[model samples]
Target: MAGDTKERILETALALFAQSGYLGTSMHDIAKELGITKGALYKHYASKQEILDSIVERMNKMDYERAEAYEMPETEPDGFAEAYLHTPIAKIRTYSMAQFDHWTKEPFSSNFRKMLTLEQYRDPKLAQLYHDYLATGPTKYMAAIFRKLTDSDDAAMQLALEFYGPMFLLYSVYDGANEKESVAPMLCAHIDRFIAKIESGYRKPHAEGA
Candidate 1:
């Protein structure tokens, strides 16, 4: 089927892009990996740029599905903001750990993250994409959620940093190790401690502790 071929092409291109940075990978490489001619590859994507665009689009689609599966609150401005404030501390822990497992376990996500990590230094576009998905974007989204939960904008941003910082560090820790099992408990413990802090007294009496 045409759709199946197109999906295969995208997967092949993404794997190649991860192994070799986008600029380092030629259309020929993808075609060769797919056991197809360059012309055949062209039928699915107009250019290498098109292939990269498709990969990004696919990543976004997968990212949303992953978030939804984790029961993450919708990031956009709808009426779902209260979900962040009221969601149980235990469920929050579950969602947080689920996300940590996903990024580390999923080949597509881990490979895409590896590609971005490698290519961001060489490409401005990739650098922006890196920030949008892994860095500032998630921070801003969390901050917005925190803002609704707390009274102060500054506190919201700080809470976002506190919440995401361990998750970020654990990614590196996960990458450096071969086994995910060892790293998971560390994340689980960290999330538990963080949430416990939030629950204990993060908010001030007026607004202070958790």
Candidate 2:
């Protein structure tokens, strides 16, 4: 079927893109890998850029779906921290592990991540995608959630950094290995410290106070 062929082309292209830099992979390579002629590939994707665009679109949609599924507390500021903290550690761990698996284990996702990582430095669009995916997008979303609790952009951003920073570092070290078991505890520890800081009404000390 036409749909199946298009899907196959996309999957083959993703694998090739991950193995070779986006700039290095060509239409002929994708066509050959898919056991299709260049003209046949054109019927599905007019150009390599079109295929790349499709991949980015699909992955972004997945992210949007995940964000939509995440539930945020509706409690008051005084109770927000406690409510968020009371969420079972097992639930948090499961979410964290799911994210780890998404980036490391899922074939399409893993290849797409690697492709973006490989091409980010060379392409402006890819660079922006990398930043949006790994940093600004999640940070901004969390900042909005935290703002409901703190009512301060600075405080919200600080909390987002404290919470997501360790997880970002963990992603770098995670290679679909035993790193998950080793890092889950550290991730939970960071969460524990972050919650403790929030409960303590943490504030930056002035030079004079110091």
Residues 91-169 of candidate 1 have per-residue lDDT tens digits of 7888888777767787777778878888989999999988887888878878877776667889888989999988988
Residue-level lDDT tens digits of model 2 in 1-210: 988888788889999999997899999999998888899889889999999888888887876565345543445554654455555545555565566667767888889878878988999998788788777876775676566456589988888887887777776676554645676676677777765665556322221243
Per-candidate TM equals 0.88, 0.75
lDDT (0 to 1) per candidate: 0.81, 0.73
| TM-score of candidate 1 versus the correct structure, residues matched by position | 0.88
- Point out where model 1 deviates above 4 Å: 75-80, 202-210
lDDT of model number 2 = 0.73
lDDT of 2 at 193: 75
Q: lDDT, candidate 1, residue 171? A: 88
